[model samples]
Target: MNAPHTPASVGATQRRRWWLAGAALLALAIDVASKSAAAAWLPGRPVELLGGLHLRLTRNPGAAFSIGTDFTPVFTIVAVAVIAGIVWYARNVTHRGWAAALGLIAGGAAGNLVDRLFRAPSVGHGHVVDFLYLDWWPTFNLADSFLICGVAVAVLLSMRNVPITAAPSTEGDAVHLADITGGRDGR
Candidate 1:
């Protein structure tokens, strides 16, 4: 029989998860720095990276590519909650990549949240800085890119179940998905 584990080991693992939190902070720093530079140096000026496909130094204050700018209050409330939840869950994430993804997303969420809190000429209402504009699409920023990519990666990772070393007490053997498979189990 496996020995009962102590709570401290679980605490250690929780602390280890902060490694990903650091990574997310780095991403957030970059996003914030870039956005600040854009707002200060190139507010209206557009830096075209590609042939009308990519741009820089544009502000977006809205959901993914300026989708919900008009509804700033609603977005801000939702964003704050999501960021809080991500930070909390990040403490228990086992997979390194998933932790990293969560960090990136948390950073992105924070980058925008900070702007909403401080960058504004008003209170609790600041526009998020965006710079990557597409002539054919809406303008965006690094934080938005990180958020979308991170969420997509997170969703994909969540679809796959990670294997656990501990087996069910009854089976006394590690379980593979095959053990659960049936004619209709493929679904």
Candidate 2:
């Protein structure tokens, strides 16, 4: 039988960490790239996708729907805190599912954080580039989509009772997801 703290277990944990980091990086890259493209081609104009779907490049100085328009610095601080929290949790990610979910959240947060730090107007007071405009929906970007989707996924996981906490060590007693979610055998 494999020991809890064996090198193999450690390797598995490392792999899990890589999964989270990789996913986050990929999401961030896509968000950044899409925003750049939108800025380049959609500025000052709107591109109709479907009937009500459109891309209208714009900069938002506040949170969703332009709330707190004068609190760019505050938003910047929140983003920093979020990124920090994600990093801290990432150190002990035990569930692959949570890794993916957290990755999306981290990536999305990082993307917007980047804009808040470097976009325009001033450092930590810059506006975020938004381009996606869906029927009657607030203008947003790839980062926003990722963030929303991530939250949805997280909620679903929680509903299913998937354990998101990490064990103190590979040798430590870990909670079995099957037990928490109730196994298919209904044991």
Model 2 C-alpha RMSD to native: 4.9
Cα lDDT tens digits, model 2, 1-187, are: 5336767557656766787799889999999999989988887889899989898988999975567888999989998998899889886676676777888898998999899998998999999998988888888888888888778877867877666644323433343555335574485
TM-score of each model, paired residue for residue: 0.75, 0.84
Tens-place lDDT per residue, model 1, 10-69, is 544464466568867887899888887787878566666767865466555677788877
List candidate 2 stretches off by more than 4 Å: 1-4, 166-187
Best by TM-score: 2
Question: Whole-model lDDT, candidate 1?
Answer: 0.68
Displacement of the residue 34 alpha carbon in candidate 2, Å: 0.6
**RMSD, every candidate, angstroms:** 6.7, 4.9
